[model samples]
Target: MLNSINTNPGALLALQNLNATNTELTTTQSRINTGKKIANAKDNGAIWSMAKMQSASSSSLNAVKDSLQRGQSTIDVALAAGDTITDLLMKMKEKALAASDTSLNSTSLKALKADFDSLRDQITKAAENAKFNGVSLVAGSAKPLVFLANADGGNFTVNAQTLGLQGLGLSTTGTTFTTAAEAGSMISKMTAALLTATNKLSALGTASTGLDTHLTFIGKLQDSLDAGVGNLVDADLAKESAKLQSLQTKQQLGVQALSIANQSPQSILSLFKG
Candidate 1:
């Protein structure tokens, strides 16, 4: 049943083998160029979806980490300002005690009052200026930052945690210091203010410690997310090298098979001549 005019059986076999070899070559070329077994969603739909999910989760956690960093900076500023206020209060107490001495006349007491007033001004300035990136946390204008509820299958929030100072008040009145018998009374009032400032500073220190722990947690989460992202996209040189070698061997074998199939028609030629 050989159709001699149009087709030779041997030639047809060779063509078929060549086609198969070309298909294999094309596939190998694709894998080499992309370096990924699954280049498209059609290749591995399930794995692609999983990788996308992991990427989205990483993005959310990265945002949370950024918020935590900013929170840490804000809390740091508050802690410094609080400590400075405490120190200034203590200095004012010392000045008041000195002014209460009987040996000092009215002029000396007046100068001491001026020094105490300067100290008060410095405290107010420190509190008012304790800010981070235009966000004031110590001037009684800021509230503790809270993360909003996450509704998008996320466990992290986008907002930072705020740390601020409170219960700090200042007065400029020197009436309790101006009288002779009331010198002891003035000392008592300044002492109370000093104690209050000390207590507030202690509370702030505790809150800052808590924020530090939270910061550490967020840092670890960020590191983990970074590693996950790398795992998804990063190449494994060893695995790729092995795959390249295997593909090269297969390609060589395919070429040899194709050449042998093309030479099959020569056998037919020998049969016709001899």
Candidate 2:
């Protein structure tokens, strides 16, 4: 090769190779630092874009999970209240049945009537208090409970179930049990109310079960989406570590090559020596 002091082609070629090696080293170091191969748009535009979109979807699912959790809590409260109402109705039925006995004295009848009235009042209280976040399913609220079910704007709804005294077909006026005939008439009403309360309880229980199932599904869906994003952008640390070692070695060799090329001009000085 022709050597010149002003312009050394070997040095330029060596410098170019060293610069390329340095660039690769920078990229490998970045991958190691961030633990992601495609940390930004510049890494791989199409893959980064897709990963970002999926990441957004995964983040949105967090809100959906929150909504579903709220819905599940509300349903749980309603289910508890419905179960209480059902138990109260059963006790009221017992009172009514005892009061219906013709052989019961006036004092016994009065005691049973008082117990029945107390149980009926407790049912109303339970229904009214069955609320979560200002939403009650059994307190005669007309609005249905709705929750986000997916990332696509889907929703799951649990219709409100009115369980008040009037809603259960129970008389607002306390049943009269002053006489045998009056006590006997209350037995049928109590039976009907028990049936209504039980049915409502069953419905609320089913809704709660459905909410639990859906929440589990949402959790799994979020996990799957996050895994998908990871597959697209996450760096393999072992692979990167090996690559970093190789690039570092190459960089050292490139620097040595450039140093050798820079010294080549000294050989021409030796040729002109006296």
Distance (Å) between predicted and true CA of 7, model 1?
Answer: 7.3
Model 1, poorest ten-residue lDDT window? 156-165
Structural similarity to truth (TM-score) of each candidate: 0.77, 0.96
Q: lDDT per prediction?
A: 0.63, 0.86
Residue 86 in candidate 2, Cα distance off native in Å: 1.0
Clashes of 2: 0
The stretch of ten residues in a row with the least summed lDDT in candidate 2 is 171-180
- TM for candidate 2 is 0.96
Q: Please state the error at residue 142 of candidate 1 in Å.
A: 3.3
Please estimate how well model 2 matches the true structure, expressed as its whole-model Cα lDDT: 0.86
Model 1 lDDT, full chain set = 0.63
Clashes of 1: 1
Model 1 Cα lDDT, one tens digit per residue, 216-254: 775676577667755654456567667667766766776
Off by over 4 Å in 1: 1-39, 147-166, 174-176, 180-183, 229-235
